[model samples]
Target: MRQNNHMLFRINLARRKFLRQGFSLLASAGIIGCGDSATTSATTPVVIPPDTDSNDTPGTLTTTSTPQQVVIIGAGISGLIAGYELQRAGHSVTILEARERVGGRVHTLVSPFTNGQFAEAGASRIPSTHNLTLAYAQHFSLALDPFYPSTNNYFYLQDNSVSLIDAEQHINQPPWPGAVNRSNFYKIRGGMANLPLALSNALAEHINYSSPVELIQQTNDQVTVITGQDQQFIADRVLCTVPLPVLTKISFSPPLSEEKHLASNGGYDYTNSTRLYSQFSQRFWHADNLNGWGDSNWPEEIWQPTWDNGESSGIIQSYLRDVAATELDTMDVEQQIANVHSRWQHVFPELDSYLLTNHIHSWQQEVWTGSAYASPTNLQDSALSAYIGLVEGRIHFAGEHASNFHGWIQGAIASGIRAANEIHNAN
Candidate 1:
């Protein structure tokens, strides 16, 4: 059950560094947005019958045994990759998804906006260091583009004071607040969600959407998965890829390890990451040579999601976590908009004048994904992290929560592959 940043903020009081991180901390610090709107065009999911008659190559592994029947829970990047690779390697894979769409936390949202402009509702940036994510993009032939703005200056609001950080200085700094060297970051050209779509397509007719797993039970030789609707799937191996929060909903027979129970049963701390995206009639800040992105003492990362798009209209997003995010969650949609408008104006004074429409994408709100990425709430959580991804008999686990890269899609991809290999090589 989920949808999903790790950009660190430049917390230094120095003027140039104030917005230097520019919503940097949210993603870098492991805070990320989750639960994209289901209406995104790129995320339209198709349900297909599970693979019954499996495929196989005339290889040693195939000749020795029958193809493994794999049940992969959650069609996120990790789950999809596991399913795709398993099916490709001649295993029968069935992916159970809670939502009608794929790409749990990595989605591209395009709606209620004009002029072919779009915004990222979930994971956006893919750093060069994320070889797995990059390699997949290349595998799918998806184009890449710089994630940061390349024009004018970055904005920051401190003590109700608006200031512009030099664009050159901003770009010269590293990716996060206090990183070693300047690194490059990129996003999929069309949208971030396309990566998952490609994976989903590759596993066509094997993905079951709107089929949430309610229970997972296993015997010595096989595992049985029961969906919320009473549908059942039996597999030689079951890979659970849901976030810790969502994972709590699925009952497990014989119970999971104490560590897994600790991590999923509210023992883990997840960020309440929220993004407020507002579209304007024109690129108003460009007149002042500002990219309409920065940070505020209000403890938020302001981003113009479509800053690079050569469109007449533009959109800006505000990334918030914890206290700031929880505060907005209490209000109605309109109130949330008003609350953001009142505060965001201090950074971009001419905001309300050019505003056309706005929407809030809060990760905690989606039923499938209850919170953002997992971070150790305390020492117990830190200790519990290692056990989160441990394999159970006839069952395995994978997700951003199970990986060191917690908040990024790369984490999910890596963990999925790890679990897939574990099952693939198992006797």
Candidate 2:
């Protein structure tokens, strides 16, 4: 179902300047009322392990106070990285997560698919342009492998007609086509989720599982955070890294300003909506020697192609938009699979026979992360600035949503580090 179903707002700018700058970027500005009219201390809080009652590793050292306490709201990649940076700088940090598991949208469900192999449900691939994540992977001794986009691609049209497609030929063409440098897509050696697991391994002590932040109240002295189970935290600084949709629902001390609300609203619009066109077990088209890329003019459900698993097998993954919208959740799994198959089977008839399993990960169905990354149209500069800006004197924000480079693991890490630095510089 549409996890955390909420409405959002739109940001309007006189012109789209970023696109003119050759980076496909946009910029704008906004203003709103100040909160509580209080001048709070900018010092950061002394952080501790999220759940210390259990035997967890002792977190990193502290620099400022006897224990420089900083409370991070989410335990996803962004939260983890924020803690890591602060700890590395000799500050105490604790991460509180809403879900039972770590890795917000970077979920990887392991199950037998073919000859005892598995596939991914959530965030799968990384691009060469993702420098921050790549650097961290290399630092952690993680192996990387290329995603095979060449082997099996097929195209399906409106009338149920199928055709073999050559992705390389259309690399620099039209209809959202960009240059393919062959090294654009890469995956972790084992699975895409391995990256987050590696990062988590580095910061074991700071994470608190199943602890969702209930309220965030900022005072002149500190920011007080209350958990769902009534656990309270008083820290000098707090990072609000929860997803935009979730953040909008949570209570803030003096209440958020109109611009901040708009930023959060626009952010929710960009982050929560998703589209999953199709999914398949094995590359049936590849067995018949066909590439697996298809094109359709559908509004949300768009393309289909082969997605590889590192262990020498893969499935055909479909791409869509708004799969997490309210209307999509009502459809049964069978109906969803059939809908995908109907769009894909005609392009590669082999899909009709070799289909062993079909699955869909409606990110919007996730309580922690409502959806995948934002679309190009959803990103704007004013929204980005407002979403990323520090609030009051105590409330700071970070996450993939609060990034210039939206929806990538690298962007998430970058935002976390930025938030950490903000805390560090404030103190």
Candidate 3:
């Protein structure tokens, strides 16, 4: 879902120019408008404890501020990491989450499919250049795999009406959208969800699932949180990690700054993305030496999420965005299936024969995340976005939206640490 800034970056450049240059983990000229992940501050390696055992050592806070009660809203990676760091720093923490399950946009689906096959609902790739993201994953001891199959022939349905197929080239575009080596791109061995699930386990007792915060009232000295259940929780400071759109759902006392309201109301822009996954009885594309990963003139990415799993039956995920995603969002699950199924048959030829089951996940439709990621549309939105991470009295904000790396996992991780530090050292 967090594919805004660093999605399948496409341009009208010549095909040769695309394959010759290769894609970079970083963005070029703000292709998706969330800036490049490479530009984010990765100087300090963020330390998020793997677990919060009762017998664990106390925090090593380096500031003069004494331990304080902290309330974190939204249990996404941002909130989870902030809670983890602050709790480790000897601060009392309470994480309020609206969702029953953890991992906001970093979702991995493993169900009904055979042989433990799964697909990511959001934030899949982990670039080698992303130090913080890589550090945290390694700190957790998770394995990594090449995101793309480098040795296989690729399919390039370069356009809809023409449906061009460049079987000779390994990949039609750069691996991502820059000059970065394709080998540098990686994914978690199991799924992207493992990272968040590990963090959630560490803070299991502190996280309140299904506890949606309805209101936030902050005075100079403290912040008061009122959940949907009418329960009141007070904290010395509050870290709000919800996306810009989700902020509108909660009532903020004294209201938010005019800049924040403008940013959320209509100034800032976020991308719309939806992923459709179809499981087939066999990996038919292999017969033609096609790795089952390609892009269409429709401007969507076709990925066999389980490509490296070496499974006979695999899942084909159509990563849709903007106009294409909007069209899919209009249809229900069945209609979404028919739409992609019809297109895949034309693109994959024999896909109709091996089709097993299908599913769809739209980021725009999520209750907690109205859009994929924050990407201010024009100069106006970008100008106003400066206020996104600005601390308001006892309340601090952090999320992919608040970070320069908008769509990348590095952004969420960095922003979480930044906000946590803001309150941890506050005098």
List model 3 lDDT by residue over 1-427, tens digit each.
1221122232112333322232122133121111112212122222233333322211123533489999999899888878887887778999999999888999999974676679998998876566567656645656555566554465666444423344324432356556355545667767899999988988988999898999999888889999999989999999999888778989999899998998888678888999999889888777666677777767788888877664668899999988899988888888888887777776688987888887888998999889898878769555876688888899999888887787888788767877877888787
Worst 10 residues of 2 by lDDT: 1-10
* Candidate 3 local lDDT, residue 206: 95
Taken over the whole model, the C-alpha lDDT of each candidate is 0.73, 0.57, 0.73
Show where candidate 3 strays beyond 4 Å: 1-65, 160-173, 176-179
* Candidate 2 per-residue C-alpha lDDT over 171-253 given as tens digits, one digit per residue, 9 for 90 to 100: 22333446334435555655667767776776788788888888888878888888888988878888888877667657887
* Cα displacement (Å) at residue 2, model 1: 38
Candidate 2: list runs displaced more than 4 Å.
Answer: 1-67, 112-116, 152-158, 167-182, 265-268, 271-283, 291-293, 299-314, 323-327, 350-352, 375-384
Q: CA shift at 268, candidate 1, in angstroms?
A: 1.3
Better of 2 and 3 by lDDT: 3
- Candidate 3 similarity to native, TM-score: 0.83
Estimate the TM-score for candidate 2.
0.74
lDDT tens digits, residue span 24-55, model 1: 33235332211112122133221112223332
